[model samples]
Target: MWRSKARQWLLRIPTPKCSPLQYQVPPGTLIASRMPSNRPLPTFTCLQNPRLLSASPSFNSRDLDDSDVGIVGNAVNADDSRESEASPVNLDGEMDESGSFGEKGQVLQEFGDSSLGFDDDKVMSEAADVDSLSSLWEESVSADDSSGVFGSQEASDGVVDEIHEVDDEQVESVLSLLQSTLVEPLEASLNKMELSLSEDFAVRVIETPSISGENLVGFFKWAWRNCRSVRTARVVELLVLAVSDVPELGKREGYMLWDLVKEIGAEKGIVKTEILNQLISMFWKMGKAKAGLEVFDKFADFGCVPNSDSYYYTIEALGKRSMFDTAWTVCEKMISSGRLPDREKIGRIIAFFCKGKKGKEAHSMYSAAKEKEICPQRSWLDSLVCSLTKNDETVSLAFELLDDYAKGSLKYANKSFADVVKGLCRIGDVKEAKKLVLRMVESGPPPGNAVFNFVITALSKGGEMEDAIALMKVMEGRGLRPDVYTYTVVMSGYAKGGMMDEACKIFSEARKRHSKLSPATYHVLTRGYCKMEEFEKATDCLKEMKKDGVQPNTDEYNKMIQSLCLKALDWRTAEQLLEETKESGVPLKGITRSLIAAVKELEVEIQSAENNIEA
Candidate 1:
């Protein structure tokens, strides 16, 4: 009877709405439960003991008074509602409010507080403790976010700063150690430290302010001795730049670094062509052209063959320092290697030779280069021929070189031939220049009239009036009309040679042909009169210049003043001419200013003499 009564009581119990179980059940397992209404019991598969579920005694308890039970039931309902609102449970029950099983247990424990046998006061105290623990957890998380592995944000930054300070201190330590130890004898220091000088160590040496060049040299020597190698390019280039930044060491004195660098490089058996070339250029920029050449010469010893650029820089540096012989040797080497210097470098070398009046050597180098099938470029040849022609000793040879080259190489024949004529004319070899001009006409189309004008001018200047006129006739026959430059050249040439009549005739011809004389044409006539001390005639020419709407430029005025002071001995007229020049807004030439001073000095001397006589 008691069992039947218990069964009835159990049957009357409504199905409780509980939280989803955390554990999973096997497939095909059945669960049975009854509803509150008069409905049949529902069967659930894959669930065990659906009628009576096991609950943890620590979370749920059966010991409760009726009043406490009522309160606990309401509290459990409220807690369930709060959990449901906090995290929605999936209907399929595949996941719970807490996806993790451990978190789900904590959730269950918190909700299980309602089933505890404690009174309302004990439950309230536990709730307050739980809230305090949650707040502490959040604050700990916040602290972790700000501090990372360190204690606080500032402490984290302080850690990073400490790391940087450690690195800086390491650098300072290394530098200080090197400064003290490197001052000792190199062998003794090496023996004591047994140092391994790496690129960083070399960089430290280069950047250290207390490091002297001698100390640097010793360090590198020691490094090379121990390691059998050195940082030839990287360390050396940095050292060079550093030394160059120092004004005292930047000049030729800085080249001492090269000696050390070379020693190190040679010891290491490292001879790179590009590095050597750069070293040469570095020396040149530092005003050590000779040192650059020295580096160039040693390139072969290091097994690096000098390229055309290498040879060009060496020759240029040598030439710039007026070391012509060495420059010529380097050029010869360049040519022997079947290479030619670049045009700009060639011009520099040629100018160097011209300044020294060693034009024959320059021409010889050109000829040798051509013989070796390494002809200079046309622009370089033009500069060379121009330089050679300016020298009296090499003008004929320069023309011969052009004439010979013209026979085989017609590409530059016309231009080369023209250079020859112009060069010969510049050297007052109009006779040769005319012959070369005819040769050029035969070889190619007629040369420009400017070529004939150069020869005519040269002949007239040489007092060969007949040759000058003949060349002019030849120019006209070739359908080349003489321009203002031509007339000016011929007239100035005749005037310089004191043949005023021929100059006048050339002027008349210019007017007849062109129908107008340029300002330069008038200046030529004025200069001619000045050279002959014909002051009145020169003055008339100036007046005609103004009447013809051409002003006498500074050169024309300077020429007249110089003649009046030097030849005419008429300081008064020179003074008046200078005053007019100033009024005309022309800047006085240096020579003109000196002439005024001379006139003032002469006047002071005359005044002193008259005073002495009066006394």
Candidate 2:
């Protein structure tokens, strides 16, 4: 009966209503219940037993009165509620708070009233339960809101994704702005950033074709000022590509590019010899020969000794621009540096002298090259021949050079043989020129149109018309069609021979063959007309000269004035010619001034004759 009563009391506790569950036990009852009882005296203790009280909901409260029980109960409930609020527990027994509850609950209970008489162990156990219950309640409340359902890990991941998206959009916007701003100032700013940033950024600036040349140059200048680490090779490549875009920049700022490359190479340390060579080459291509020399001077700073190829480029650049003195200095520098000049480079040095019309210097260089077993090639030999011929020197040097080739003492390729022949013809040495031509036909590759034209011109200028005509036959026999020069030479020969009819026939035949007449040919024909006293025909030649856009040289003007004064005997005509000569601004040398003075005297004579005839 007592067991049934204890059971009924437990059931009537109303299940704690999901509110704070506070268990309050009487103080003495806890000790009495815990004391091992041997006697079975009480009916409740015997039937259900205080041992069952160990399992009973309120067994420790049995020793206390109702008021003490109520007080303990209220205090316990209040403590439970406070702990629950501190850390709500999930239904699955997980805490929903920040896991800082145990310490907080200990502090709170320690500062509270001692009337409750809460045991330290009991208080700690109750605090732990309260924490668990609080966690459950928090979880339930959080579940109702969708945003709060996210775990810390998932929330952190979402924040990172948003950040990445924002960064990507910002990058895209910047790229778009770069594309749209085609102006030089803005593009230059972009290029500056690229140079400062990474290689990918630099490459983007390089690959963007929308950037104009002015902007690209400005960018390079900025880079040179700011980016001290840029490689010389990269700057050269960028400038080279940029040159094709802005030809004007090439004219104005090309030297600046060269200077910047030199600066970068000097500052960054020359890690690549090829890059140094390229930088030197770019200076030449940009027509900055002095800049190329400056680059050469910087080579020593990088610990690179000047090589033959280095001297070759520098000398060749100077030579091309007619800077013979500078070119010779470079050649001497190369030799003094203990680097033997390569045969090809030596050939270029010789060609430079030839190109500059310095025949004496060229011959010296050729002899030096030969002494070193560095045989001048055919092209070099040809240049030498042309140089000597233009200077109108005694052909003995050229003959000696050719003889060396003929004796097989110097390496003579077929082209070298042809070069000697062309050289003889260039100097108007008709007999020697013809001899060389016959030798070429006998031993070398059969003479082509170029060789034939040279020989024909030599014979024509030497007043050997028949010989020139015979050579034209030989040319046709060799299956070589005479070009315009051949025809011009033959006609000029006839004109010099005073065989006007034959020259006219040849000129007509040449026209029939559709050969384009050159300015020299017209000048020759005009002289021929003056020689025949055909002053009207000479005037027609002058009109043709104008039509062909050929400016009359001093000789042509002298011939025209002489013919007009002698044939027309008109004072006004002679004065008009003199005035035209003065207006043309051609330099009047000894022969030209004499012609002008003669024409004035003739005009005075004509005026005297008119006055005498009138008187």
Candidate 3:
């Protein structure tokens, strides 16, 4: 059976043997087989069946001739006996495998142990087994090739699983090793790979989320450092992906990328618009606005004329932060570059001025826009009108300009009409304001709530309380709900006319309606109470002012104190109020001193009258 096992092992090898004389055992065979002891063999009864033995060439060595049987049997017994004496081993490379004498022998030799005896039969048997194993391996490899088995199919299927198992350990080791010795060479290799695969693979690789952004950036920097044009585009693509993934990295390394782009421009003659945009956006997002602008300037030097969207992004960033001056400068640069600013950018500029209450500049910009044939859109006109109304002088000019422009053949005339009417009423132009409103209602859509509110405010301020009320009724009749401004204006009108009951009624109505009450509304009410000589009511309003988180200005405080003094005819309280004002950090200006002097004069006249009456 043992001889048969040897023969079977040999027959499984597909390669034809050279003449028997040419067969030689490898050098380690002899040392591997020799041992001092032996053990019982595994059961060979399974191989006792003749039919089974005959069916398997690997198990049929008993059918060989006597000489062949003798040689095969001796080799088999020798290898088995030697293997039986070998010690068992563990998986950590610290021990030899059981029944494998070669590994033990090598270990023992290294430890200076040569007392073990050698066995020639064991050596020959081991040599024959090794030959058979090599022949079987070669045959299996060829068969796999002929059968069209892919080399890495199995590896590919298990790659993720394998990576999960090994990544933690291998990543650190591999990265450290790569860093220590292979960095430059690996960088060069990656650069070459980038150049070769740019056209074919860049898009796919860049869009992959699993790719390491740091690695991608490193490779890009390497490629840029080497002045490799062939890889520049691919490197750029990877850099874009890196920036998209890790925006903070771009901010930290923006200057380096900028320098790289400049180098690319000098070496490859390729202008990198995408890189410039990425750098700008990154710096802006990181709150480095100045750096963002610097990169934008570089884009121009690279002959990259930024598109409208780019300008819009930069301008909007500045405008949102109330940096109107910067935004205007950027706008000028954009226009000077022959790029027309869009409506959104223009709207932002208008909003910035409105927020800052720079009415004159806003109006100037609007006029400039019109002169450039840039038809201001509805939103731009709305903001412009609001801004103009903040200052009286500009408001009148703005209304006239809008009226004139609307009369012309300009396309935006209809929108301009609404804007002018709103501006006119905003600045208290009652007659012309009513005319514009009538024109709008007769020829166009009926007056909007904003238009009605403005007209009511103008009429109320002009003391046309009846007309203002009529307009409010008209608005309600037209199913237009009056807003807080309408109620506030009417209440102010009643208060100015000393109609305390009417003013209180309007205030109660406003509160019940839940209409908005702004600081100006409160100011109007406070002044009204003072005019009525209702000091307690006025003080109550001031307390409400505090509760509402409104900081009363020096004017409001001064008016309140003056009204209190006048009502009580108390000179001492008035003087104390002036001292309190100084303590509250309100500087005593020339007007305040004059009022104090006038109060002292009244006190002198009162004292002289009292003295004469007593005499």
Candidate 4:
């Protein structure tokens, strides 16, 4: 029976109603029950139940003033007509006697409240608490609405001022602020922000890119001045690493970053050689070789000893720019210190030095590499050998290096062996080159056509045609077919020694072995025929060159014209060759044309003088 009463009383609560004259509820609108004026109201706490106490839809704010709500827990009977006329719940008009509930007020006028059971004291207490409930709820909702969203610009704007308490949210806040800020000066942009730079924060600033490198440096500088935490060694390292990874880091930014690091390092005495090495490498990427050297020179200033990477990078920087003299000083310092880097870097160092014509100076670095038992790359080792062979005095050193190839310094190959042989030929050491070729024939990586050709060419150049011919026979016997270049070199050497018959014999052998010949091959035999004053043979060799699909270049045509006009004084043939070169669109020198005309005129003058003498 009591449960049935509870349900009846619950339905009896009033639902919100709209006014006949449309009305909008202002903020903090309130609702309350209307009671009879003739008797005291019942004690109630809004029954503290969801269904028994319903809110007016118009009173939507949780922050409404508590002054309008009061203790209404008692009920009493009144005249029916008066109650109906004064009740705020009346849909006919206003539902109150004095209408204190106002035009838009909603209430339950007669719900038979006397039988509805609620604990009197508990109900009264809950009613009193509602007075302050609105304020508390309003405060919470307002706070959340202010800062509830992610990456809110206004929420993160004041982060720099809140650095004492830090988290990922704050860090991300700072990052987005920095990226989106339009303030010209970075420090000025950060002026209003609360900044406490952690190592991780500094790293994110550097590595979380989008800000220009200049702006990043600007942010870094500002942090240095305003935040001491950013000056730590770990942060500086990450800064350097991050900067190094930026391939397009500007020179100005690099210098600025270096300055910041230098200042921090000098203050903390935490500057390291590895960090400085990283800077040098970064500068090399920036194409600042001199800057790299400058970094190298600062090692003593920082009390850090120069390590192998230090020297290698410095030399590499200078070497890439062809600054051998500057690179050599670092090389010498490395040598004197008795240290060298890994084989790849060491090989590159050798290559750099060699490219700058400092192969002899690079030898010391190579020697240090050897003493350390670090074998460089084969290409770089070959580079070192080739560099060493540039000087006649260093040729023996290169030979020793080659000899060490058998001892595991580098692998012996046909190409490297041929390089040494060519070096010997370059410095006019044919006999040694010959012996090396013979040695190659007897050993592994046995001599190929190139090896035999270098020795043969050298021998033929030194007027040792007999030795040259024997080397060619050796080439054939070894089943190494001579190429067009090989035949050309051999014939060149023979022609220079006035051995045209032997040169022609070599040419015949080249033609038999290959369908085509190099222009130099035809040039060699043509010059040989000219040197023998055999014009017919020279012309025939040139025509044979074209028939074999060898297009004569400018040098070939020029040499032929020069030989005919100057050496043989055959103007007619010179003009014919010039016209052929023009028809083929080959560019010939004007001097050769003038020479032909002069020779032709001289022949005419001699003929006219003979005619006058006969007359």
RMSD of each: 24.9, 25.5, 21.6, 20.0
TM-score of each: 0.43, 0.36, 0.43, 0.56
- lDDT tens readout by residue for model 4, 1-615: 322332333333332332312322222222343445443322122232232122222333233233333222222223323324432432223335764344443343343533334544444444433324334334443445423411233434433234444467767776776678565666776776776666667777777867665667677777778777777767667667876776577888889878877776667467777889999998877878998998899898888899988888888787668788877888889889976787778777777778777777777777788788885556766787877777778887887777656545333556667778988898988888889988877765677777787787778678887887788788878887777777787788888878888888888988898887778788888888888889889999889988988999998888889888888889999999999998999998989888999999999999999999999
What tens digits encode model 2's per-residue C-alpha lDDT throughout 1-615?
Answer: 322222223212212222332332211222111111232211111111122222223333234332321111112233333433444322222343654312211111211234334454554544433234335434443443423322233442444222211243433443454446554565454554432333333344555565555555555555446544434456446555654345344545556555555555555443345555655666776677887777777777766667767887887766657788887777777656655577776776777777777777778777766766776677776677656655556355766666555344333455545666676666656688787777767766467788778788888878888888898898888777777678878888888888878887887777667535666777778888888877777778777766657677777777677667666654455456667778888655565456656767877898899999999
Backbone clash count, each prediction separately: 0, 12, 3, 15
After superposition, which runs of candidate 4 have C-alpha atoms over 4 Å from their true positions?
1-176, 182-231, 242-248, 319-322, 389-394, 406-412, 481-615
- TM-score: which is higher, 1 or 4? 4
Question: Cα miss at 507, model 1 (Å)?
Answer: 7.0
Q: In model 2, which runs have C-alpha deviations exceeding 4 angstroms?
A: 1-196, 207-210, 217-248, 262-280, 286-288, 293-298, 301-304, 307-309, 335-349, 364-376, 389-396, 404-615
Go through the candidates in order and give each one's C-alpha lDDT.
Answer: 0.61, 0.57, 0.57, 0.69
**TM-score (C-alpha) between model 2 and the true structure:** 0.36
lDDT of 1 by residue, 100-145 (tens): 2222211122222323334555544444322343344344545654
Give candidate 3's error at residue 320 in angstroms: 5.4
Q: Where is model 3 more than 4 Å wrong at Cα?
A: 1-214, 225-227, 231-238, 245-250, 341-388, 391-426, 448-457, 460-615
Top candidate when judged by TM-score against the true structure: 4
